[model samples]
Target: MQSAVYPSLAGRTVFITGGGSGIGASLTRAFARQKANVAFVDIARDASRRLVDEIRQDVGVEPLFLACDLRDVEALKASIDTARERLGNIAVLLNNAANDDRHRLEEVTPALWDERIAINLRPMFFAAQAVVPQMRELGGGSIINFGSICWRIGTPDLSIYATAKAAVHGLSRSLARELGVHGIRVNTLSPGCVMTERQLRLWVTPRKQEIILSNQYLKRLIQPEHIAQFALFLAADDSAVCTAQEITVDAGWA
Candidate 1:
C-alpha cells in the first residue's frame, strides 16, 4: 500500500457503508492501516465477514461489519445504532453505497426510476442523519459521499443513475452548510471509470474500454486505492477546511 497522507486514526471511529467490496472495501483497508476503529455495512454477509477477518488478521484492528440493506431506512438506522454502541461515536461516516441501473431512456419505467433514486440517493441522507448526533457528541466528524463522473459527462443508458448522483452533490453541499456550525463536514468524492469487479463484469467490454480510454488524458484505468486515498484525506483532519465540494479522482477524465 502507498503511504497514507494523514496517518494515526488511532483513536477515531469510522463508519463506512457498502464496504463488502469495490471502493468501500478498499477504503476500509486503508483506514485500518491508519489505525482507525473501522465499522462497515453490507448486505452480503460472507463478503463483509471476509473483509472483517482480513483486516483483523493483517492489521490487528477488528472492524465491525453490519449486514443490512441500506435501502431500508429503518434497518440502516438500526445498524448505525449498533455500530455506535460497538465502536464508539462515529468520527467518520462514509456514505459509499450506491447502485447503477444502466437502462436505455425508453426502457426506464417510473418504478425503476424511483428504485434507483432510493438506492443511490436516499441512504446517504438517512445514514448521515443517523450519525450526525453521535458525531456532535464526539465534538465533530466527516461525511464522505460517493459521486460519479457519469453525472458530469453524461452516459447513454444511465440517466436515472446520473440524476441520482447529481442530487448527491446537492445533498453534500446543503448538508455542509447545515452542519458546519456543528463541526461536521460533508463532501462528495466523484470517481471516474475506476474498473472494479462489477464494472468489468457488467460494463467493461473491449469496445467500451477503448471508448472510455479515448476520452481520458491518462488512458489508464483508475484504481479503487486512488479513491481510497482521497476518502482518507476527506475523513481525516487534513481536510478540516474542505467541505461541500466535489473532489474528482478520475485521472482527469472529467
Candidate 2:
C-alpha cells in the first residue's frame, strides 16, 4: 500500500458501511493506508472478510468487519457500537451503504418505494444518530454520506433511487447545521457512474458504457479509487472547514 496522500490518520478511527466491495471497499483500503482504525459493515460476509484480511496483510492493521444488512436499523446500530468497542472512538463515518431499485414512476409500488427509502436514506440518518454522541465525546468527527448523480441527471427507471439520493443531499446539509455545535461536519459525496462490479454485471452494457463515457468530458469510466481519494480528503484535516456541501466525482458527467 502506498502512503496516504492526505494527512495521516494514525490515531483516528473510521466506520464505513457497505465496505465489502466497490467504492466502499476502495475507501476501506484508502483509509487503512492512512493508518486509521477502520471498521466497516457489509452484507457480503465473504467479501468483507477477504477485504479485512487483505488490508491486514498490506497495511498491517486489521479493520473490523461487521456483516449486517443496512436496512435493519437495529442490526446496523449494533454493528457500529461493536466497532466502537473494538476501535475506540469512530472519528469519521462513511454512510455509503445503498441499493438502487430501478423502476418507472408508475411502476413503483408503495412497498418498493419504502424499501428504497429504508435502505438508501434511513440508515444515513439513523447511523449518524447512533454515532453523534460518540463523536461528540471524541471532540468532533466527519460524517460523509453517499449521494448519486442519478438525482441530478433525472435518469430513467430510477425515480425512487434518485429521490432517495436527493434526500441524502438534504439530510447532509440539515445534519451539518444540527451537528455543527458539536464540531461534527456533514457532507455528501455524489458519484457519477463508477465502474464497480455491480455496474459491470447489471447496469452497464457495452453500448450503454459507450454512451456513458461519451457523456463525460474525460471519456472514461470513473474508478472507485477516484471517489475514495475525495473521501479521504473529506475525512482528513484538509476538509476541516468544508461541510454541508455535495462534492461530485463523476468525471464531469454531472
Among these predicted structures, which one has the highest lDDT? Answer: 2
lDDT of 2 by residue, 1-254 (tens): 25356665677889999998999999999998888899999999998899988988988988889889988999999998998899898899999988874777788789988888888899999999999999999888999999998967878888878888988988999999999999999999999999898888987899988999889988877889989989999989888889999999988973
lDDT of 1: 0.88
Instruction: List residue ranges in candidate 2 displaced over 4 A.
Output: 1-4
* lDDT tens digits by residue: candidate 1, 53-171: 99889999888898998878999999889988988999999999888847888888888987888889999999999999999998889999999989678777888889988888999
**Cα error, candidate 2, residue 15 (Å):** 0.5
The TM-scores, one per candidate, come to 0.95, 0.95
Clashing pairs in 1: none
The Cα error of candidate 2 at residue 51, in Å, is 1.3
TM-score of 2: 0.95
